[model samples]
Target: MNVTLEQARALDALARQGTFAAAAKALHKGHTAVLYALRTLEEQTELVLLDRRGYRTRLTPAGERVLEHCRKLLEAERELEAACAEIRAGWEPTLRIIFDGIFPAEPLLRVVKQLRAEGAGTRFHVSAEFLAGVEAAFTRDEADLMVSVLPPTLPDLRSYRLADLKAVLVAHRSHPLATQRGPLKDEELARHLLLTVRGSDPRLQLSTGALEGRSTVHLNDFAAKKAAILEGLGYGWLPEHLMKRELRRGELKALKLASGATHLFHPSLHHRAGVRLGRAASRVVQALTGVELPTPP
Candidate 1:
């Protein structure tokens, strides 16, 4: 038996409104039309979908199951209509953004939340990568935009300086290096493990703040590296922003290095040169450049 979307819609309205007249009012249709649609749906499915015996109509057990499926169809139709409207309004259907994991995601996510509320209907696929992995993913996926510390030397690349990420060399308070008063020497640091995040793209060789001939452990992301460092596993560089609570609690201490304890990473927003950005991408760039960005929660 073939069931129509119109029939599904009628059943949905009837289930929601709880009465035929109420359902008709909600659908902007006559009471008779609503009744006919429900009747046809029941006949087509060979199921007693509605229990009309009640003072106010209610769906039978089978009707509830059918309603669940009908709701999905209605939701899909709504999404399709929304997508079409977005396309007509010159919003890109999808935007892929690859950013360095070291960069804070709150600002970008806050901007996205604002854009979504403003009816900028671009679907976003955001990925956080480490160092060279950001550029690698951006090039491999031909992503719409990227936020990276390693700006690729491509001919048609456009980049805008977003923010400087201050990275501090840190270790757990209980670690041997934490007790050292003076600037940590090369030999002192080399004696412990260096917790570092491995780039997503293994083929591209990259490292940050690593010493030669040091005992090392590669991790997947900064979160894992942070966990390892907090467990007194090793010492490595961490974003200063991420260390605020730990530093305040005396759980993690910044190392005073002979070379330097802190370094600045200039992560920038990059896109293809000469390519005009859609509304969503433009908003992202604007927000990243400190234009009316919401305060971090």
Candidate 2:
């Protein structure tokens, strides 16, 4: 094929920017240059790439398929650049991390601030998952590092214990369950609505701190779960660190269950075994482990 990376890039930019003029501005090239690149690409491929049938510029069917491949090519180019940088310097161009919802944010923020202050040039992509969701992210290779309450038992994975997070079953002061004076029975607790975090895996539909066969309110994230509980919607377990203020102010009351009221979740830092981690990933692991920070590169 006579296609070049520049032609693919120009096509991708044009598709993203909608018009040749906008694409030219985005690529820092003249309008004629942008048009020429796309025109050359179509001629080489023997396909009409753009449809001018409507007022708005749209990609033809073949154009859409070619654009999709071009996007993949662009992504590969970026990865190539990052790989080159890693060979020259011991630093990664990007680091992706996934944290379970129960993991504390304060410490993570502090660590990120320190990384930034140290002039770490690595780009960060952070996301939050819950329960089995963390394991799913790791399994799918979505993140370079993961902080999870339940570490998957995969042969290719390695884990390091970071910290134990404490969780307590709590309810708003005005809730019916909160009025009970002593340890709650399973049946009594199960009678009320339970707010729980929904797992991402459709096959599993797993949950923590939730009773089966009970009326339940399922929220996608911890923040929403906390909000639902605060509104007296239901009682559910929350990370102690997240609700300490509410617990202290008596806005929420921790329940004592006959079985157990508190649970300790051991969160661990996990990564793929036998894979060399970049400098930024190494530093993040140290931060999570409470080890002394390494000298800045």
Q: Whole-model Cα lDDT per candidate?
A: 0.83, 0.80
- Of candidate 2, the 10-residue stretch with the lowest lDDT total is 199-208
Per residue, candidate 2 scores C-alpha lDDT tens digits across 2-44 of 7778898899888888988898999999999988999999998
- The residue ranges of model 2 lying beyond 4 angstroms of the native Cα positions read 1-87, 199-210, 291-297
Expressed as tens digits, the lDDT of each residue in 1-297 for candidate 1 is: 777788889999998899999999999999999999999998888999989897999999999999999899899999999899887776888989999999998988998899889878788998898887788898899898899887576668878887688888899999999989998787788888887787222232223244624477889989999999999999888898887999999999988876677877788888897777777887788888854322222
lDDT of 2 at 217: 74
Give the Å error, residue 198, model 2. 0.3
**Cα lDDT, model 1, residue 205:** 25
Q: Which regions of candidate 1 deviate over 4 angstroms?
A: 1-76, 199-213, 290-297
Q: Would you estimate the TM-scores of all the predictions? A: 0.73, 0.66
